[model samples]
Target: MIETKDKKWSMFGHILMIILSILSLAPFVLLLVSSFTDEATALKNGYSFFPEKLSLEAYRYIAEQWELIGNGYLVSIIVTVVGTLAGVMISAMLAYTLSKHDLPGRSVLMLLLTFTLLFNGGLTSTYIVYTQIFNIKDTIFGLLLPNLLMNAYFVVMLKNYFEHTIPSALLESARIDGATEFQLFYRISIPLSVPMLVTVGMTVALNYWNDWMNGMYYLSANSNIQSIQTILNNINENIRFLQQNNVGTAMTTADLPSATVRMAVAFVGILPMLVFFPVFQKWFVKGATAGAVKE
Candidate 1:
């Protein structure tokens, strides 16, 4: 009787998960279809999974704006790569230090790092500090510096992985054999922490890729230096404002693929992540359980 009940519940859980999966994927399906549907059909019939007429007008419009979009892509890619690499290395190194029980002021440092999660300087102050002190404005550093460099939660997760997942004896043995702290960190901890690193790397990469605020704030004057997200946001805003305010008398709202074109732009923005996810999916699954102690 218990076995039969368990089997029924398992089947129920599977059905529930399948339903959830469909719900999650439904938006992307709509987006994909809407992007391909021409301006007229979408406006009259509304967004649908299957549009009566298919058109590549939205994509063509995006391609025409490729000059801006292309540069934006290059800038975003550079920032994401440089920031992710730097963030991961710094995070791992800091976590390793904090994980060492013998390290002095470790608790205090951890407390400070945790404090950042709860509190931060207001936007105006941050902007002043970056602009006045750091002076990163209108440069490539402006795109790479803000918010993406380090994460406190990532440090804690990595610290836990180091302490709990790795055997202390192995570390002690390495130290006893005269391996420098840097050597152990580079050769031992890093190699063993690939799963966690890749997982954290993905999160870091997404943060950098999707970021536009830094571009908006610091690169405000330099449109050429703006990231893809920043450029897309500008394009969306420009289109909406012109349509609403009737800035151009001859420019008809119905003529532009404002709604459908957004979907095309979004698809292009997220395309890189989609391509790389399958490669990192396995590592992400493993790393989520990185801190669990196996008996």
Candidate 2:
């Protein structure tokens, strides 16, 4: 009887989750359809959930501007990969050290790290520090350094996973076998913490991929390292706003599919994350739950 009740509840929960998932996905479906519709048709029809008329002009226009856009994509991919790896490693190390109660001054260090989470210097001050003090403005280092180094929340999550899930006896046994701290960390702890690492890495990668504010703050349009999100946003804004400003000019009916291009740009920009999310979903969920119930 209990098994039957549990199964029924699980089935009902699955049904509810499916409905919510569809609702969340509906807007993206509409956006994909609208991107294929002409600007005039979209404006007239207000973005139907299905394509009113199929067209590829927008994608072609984006292709025409592919040199700059492609460069941005390359830059974003490099930043995301490098930043995620570096950030996850650093965060995991700090988290592991903090998880060890034997470490002196760990509490103080944790408090200092947590302080940043609650209060940060305002934007202007941070900008001044990065540009004037660090001299990283308009550089690749500026884009990657500020956001890629460390995050308090990710540290806490990792620490929780280490403290609760990794047995102390395992570390003790390794230490008895003459395993150095570094060796144990690399060989033992890391292998056991794969789920958390994947979760944190994916989160950091997504942040780097979707980031536009960092680019706005630290990058110039003339720079060689514009991120894909920033480049796409600039393209969308220019197309949407410039057309109105240049109305009644030779460009008014120049066959530029601005609406479709915006959609294509969005589609291309999001493609990497879409590919990555499902690959990491199982590990992410496991890590999230493992970290959630800390003793």
Per-residue lDDT over 142-169 for candidate 2, one digit per residue giving the tens place of the 0 to 100 score: 7688886548899999999889888888
Q: How many clashes does each candidate structure show, in the order listed? A: 0, 0
Steric clash pairs (candidate 1): none
TM-score of each predicted structure versus truth:
0.90, 0.89
Q: Measured by TM-score, how close is model 1 to the native structure? A: 0.90
Candidate 1, residues 1-295, lDDT tens digits: the string is: 9999999999999999999999988998888889999788988999999899999988987888899899999988889999999998889999999999989998899899899878888899988988889999888888777765448889989899888887888778899999999998887788778788887898999999999889888986455888899988888888788778767657577677888888888888888887888878977667556634356
**Clash pairs for candidate 2:** none
How many pairs of residues in model 1 come into backbone collision?
A: 0
Q: What is the lDDT of candidate 2?
A: 0.83
Alpha carbon lDDT at 229, candidate 1: 92
Task: Tell me the deviation in Å of residue 228 in model 1.
Answer: 0.8
